[model samples]
Target: MTAAQARTGDKNCRVVQWATGNIGLRSLRAIIEHPKLSLAGLYVYSDAKAGCDAGELCGLPPVGVRATRSIDDILALKADCVLYMPQTIDVDDLCSLLESGSNVVTTRTEFHHPARLDRAVRERIEAACRRGGTSLHSTGSSPGFITEAMPLVLLSLQRRLDVLRIHEYADCSSRDSPEMIFNIMGFGQAPNPQAEAGRAWYLREEFGPSLRVIAEAVGLSFDSVESSGQVALARKRTTIAAGVVEAGTVAAMRTTVSGMRNGKPLMSFTANWFVSYDIDADWKLRGDGWQVEVEGDCPLDMHLHFTVPEARKAATTPGYTAHRAINAVRYVCAAAPGIRTSVELPQIVTDLSAQA
Candidate 1:
C-alpha cells in the first residue's frame, strides 16, 4: 500500500525524534509544542541522555517523554513518522527505520536526492520503502531550502531565467562539533590543493544531488556538475566554541557546485563558512544571512536575515533546519511511499500558536 493509502486513525500524528544533538533538541521542542503532533518517543545516542525527560534535554520543564538509546525501543513505538536528525549520515540506520514502517523526515542531505547515491544503496532504500510502504525526505537550511527550494520559488516570478546563484555565509565558530569542524570541514589543516580537492568532492557528495534536484524541478538540464573549493588561512590563533585554531591553519572555506549547461554555468550553489572573524579574506554577499541572485530578463537579488542575540547566532541555522523537517512531517506521512524531496511535498506551514 502507498503512504497516502495507509491509515492512522489517531487525531495527533505520533512522532519519534531520533537523536538529540543541536538539531534534534530543537526538533524535539518543536514536536512537543506543535498542536497536531505528539512526542511519542525520544531516541538518543549518548548513555548520559538516556532516561532523561525530553523537555529537560531542551532546557524546558519535564514533558514526561524519556530518552531511549535502543533502536528497538524506538521501532516498537506506534509512530506515524520519525524526525531523524543526527550529526552524521547513516544510511543503514535510516533504512532500518523505514523498513520497520515509519515515514521519516531528516536534515541529512545524503537522502535529499537518492538518485545521486550508489545504485546498490539507492536500491536498498527503495526496497525498504517498498517493503514497509514508507517515505523518507531529507532537507536542511543550506542544501535544503536555501539552495534548492528557495531559489526555485523566487525564479517562478520571472517570465524567463538565465542564471541562478545562491550564496551562504555562516560563522562556524559557534558550532560545537569538533569532528565536523576539523575532519569534515578541514578547518585547522594546512592548505593544499590536493586536500582542497578532496573537500570539494565531499561538497559534491553532499550537496550535488540537491543541485540536480533543483535543476530538474525547474525544467533545466545540466550536461555536467562541476565542483571547486578554496580555503582562507587564519591570520592569528583563534579560540571558539568548538576548539582552538592555530595561526596559519585553515580558518575559512568557500565551495561551489555548479551545474553546467551548454558549457556555461546554469546554476551555482556556493557556501562560505568561517570559524573566526579574522581570516586571510572576508567575503560577504549582503553582510550576513543567505543571498539568492538570479540573472535573466528581470534580474533579481534577495537577502534573508534572522535577528537573534549574538550568542545565539550559531543556533539559528540548526533551528531553521529542524523546523524545516518538523513542519513537513504531516506531508511526508501522507505522500507516496518512496524517497521524497521538498518538490513532492506540500507547502510547509509553521505552527506559530505555541511560539512566545
Candidate 2:
C-alpha cells in the first residue's frame, strides 16, 4: 500500500450508519459497497429493525453487520465514524453521540452552523471532537454540497464578481417523503386542522441552509433574507407509477434574498416544486460576456428518463448533486473537524468526474 493508504489503514476506520430509512438505506448501500469503507454497525431506533441484518434491509446481501438499537453497542464496537441521517431531532441524543468519541457525518441542516445551535451543545460537540481527536460533518443533498459548492467553483472562472445566483427546483412530490412533509410542501391532501399543525414546510428550512453555504463560499453573508410561497392547484389530477397526485394546488413558491454583502442577497429566487415543474428549472448565468444555461435530470438510475420529454434532466440533476456530495466528502473529511456549517467548511471542487 502507498503511504496514504497505509495511514488510512492504520486507523482501521469502520462506519456506523445511524438510520435505515430511505435516504439512510441509499447511503448505506453506497457506503457498504465501497471498497475502502466497511460497516461497523447499524443503529436504528425502531425495535422492529433491531437485530435484523443491516445489509438485507438496505437492499443488499448480508455483510455480517447486524442492526442494533443500542448506541452503547455502536461505541463498544469502536466505530471510527458515523454517518447519521437527519431524522433524529433530539438534542440530547446528539450530545451523547458527539461525546462518544466517534467522528460523524450527517445530513442535518440544524447543524449547518454552530452559531445557530445552543451554545452549550455546540461547545460539547466541539470539545468532544477535540478531546477524542475526531470530527463532525453535517451536510445535505442540496444545502450541504451542491448549490453551495457549485457556485464557489464557478467563481474560479470569473475575472470579476457582480452577482451570483443558485437555483434548485425539485419535484419533491416525486419523492416518497412523509405526508406531513408532503402537505407542508402543498402536496397530498387539502387544508385540514390537523394538517395545518403539521405544516412545517421543507423549502426554506431545507433550501435556506444551502444559501448560507453559498454566501460563505463566495466570502459573503446575508443578514436579512425575504421568502414567500404560493400554493398552485392543478387544473387536473395526475398520477405517476407511485400514485395519484393533484395537478394544481400550491403549485409553487418563490424565495429570494437581496441585501448585505455578508448575509445580504444581491439577488435570489426560489420556485416551489409545483411551479418549477409547470415552468422550467434550467440554470442560467450572465457574466464576463458569458451566458450558460444548466438543467438536467438527477443521476440516479431509477430517476433517469432519457426517453422522457421533460424529465430527462430530472434524473441527471440529482446525480450531479449526489456526485458532488460524494466528491466533497474527501475535502470535508480532511478539513478542520467539528460540526461546521457550510460556510465554515473550506471551498470544495464540485466536478464529480474529477480525479482525486
Candidate 3:
C-alpha cells in the first residue's frame, strides 16, 4: 500500500511527538491533557530518555506513551500526526516525515518563508505531503501569532495606516537551553550586521508576514520594501537567570522595516527584544487625520486578550505560539502545501471576537 494509504489505514490515531525540549514538552502535555487529542508516541533525540513515560517528563500522571530514540521506529508506529519541535536539525528530517504520510505541526522558523529554502527540501516536503494526502504547517510566536494575528486585528478600526510598527520583547534567559539565548540575541556576531545589509530576512519573514496582515486589512499593497536591524547592547549586573546567561554581553536587537506603497513609504514597523522583562506588540496609524497607538498590556493579554501572572508569562508564550502552529496543520493536511509567504497566508483572527 502507498504511504498515504498506510497512514490512514492505522486504526489508532497515534499523535507522535518529536523533540522533548520546552515546546515539545508543551505539545506533549497539550496533546495528552487535552480532551480532544490522544498521546500516541514520542520521539526524543537523546538515548537517556528512551523508554521513559512521556507524562513523567511533564510532571503529569502516566498516559502510556513512551519516549523513543529512533525516528525510524517512531515512523514504524504509523502515527496519524507528529508534533515536531526541533531547535536545530536537518530539514531532511522534516521532509522524511512528510513523505512518510504523517501530518505535521512544527515551531521551526523555516516555514515562515518556505520559498527561499533549499529547493530539494521544499519539493520533498511538498511531494510527500501531496502523495500522502497529509498536511504540513509552520507556525510559532513572533512569526506566527503576534506577527500574523495581532496586526490583522488592528485593521478592525478601519483607519488609514501611515506607519505600522510592531515592537516585541522576548526574554530568552527564561528559556531552558543555551541555544535559545543565541537564537534571540543573534550571538557570536558583530553588532547589527543584519541591519547594514538592509536584509534582515528573518525579521522580514516575521514583520513582513505581519505587515501583510495589516495590509490586507487596510486595503493596500506594497510594490517595494526596505528593512534594517541593529543589535542593542546593555550592561548586565548579574546573570539574566540562574543558568541561562552571564553578566556582560550584547543582549537584544532593534529591527525595523518600511513597507512602501507605489514607491512611497506608507507603513513602518520596529521590533525590539531585551534580556530584561518586557513583551508586547504595538502599532501606530493615521486615519481620519488622527494618529493612534495600539498597545497591549503585555504580549499575551494583547494577543490573546487575557492577563496572566508575570511569573507565569514566560510559560504562556510557547503555548500561544504552539496553538498557532497547531492551527496551521489543518490547512497543510488538505493537499495545499508550499513556501507560503505572508502574502500567501494573509492575516485573519479566529478567536478575538469570541473573547468579548
Error of 3 at 61 (Å): 1.6
> Residue-wise lDDT of candidate 1 within 91-116, one digit each (tens)?
78888899999999988888877777
Q: What count of clashes does model 2 give? A: 38
**Candidate 3 residue-wise lDDT, 229-268, digit = tens:** 7654544433555243333445555566767887766565
lDDT of 1 at 105: 92
TM-scores for all candidates: the values are 0.88, 0.72, 0.70
Q: List the residue pairs that clash in candidate 1.
A: none
Best by lDDT: 1
lDDT winner between candidates 2 and 3: 3
Stretches > 4 Å off in candidate 1: 1-10, 173-184, 234-249, 276-287
- Scored by CA lDDT, what does every candidate get? 0.83, 0.54, 0.59
**Candidate order, TM-score descending:** 1, 2, 3
- Show model 3 residue runs off by greater than 4 Å: 1-13, 156-161, 171-202, 205-225, 231-239, 242-252, 258-260, 263-269, 276-307, 327-356
Q: Write the residue-wise lDDT of candidate 2 on 204-240 in tens digits.
A: 5555555655665656666755554434444456553
Preferred candidate (TM-score higher): 1 or 3? 1
* lDDT, residue 303, model 3: 28
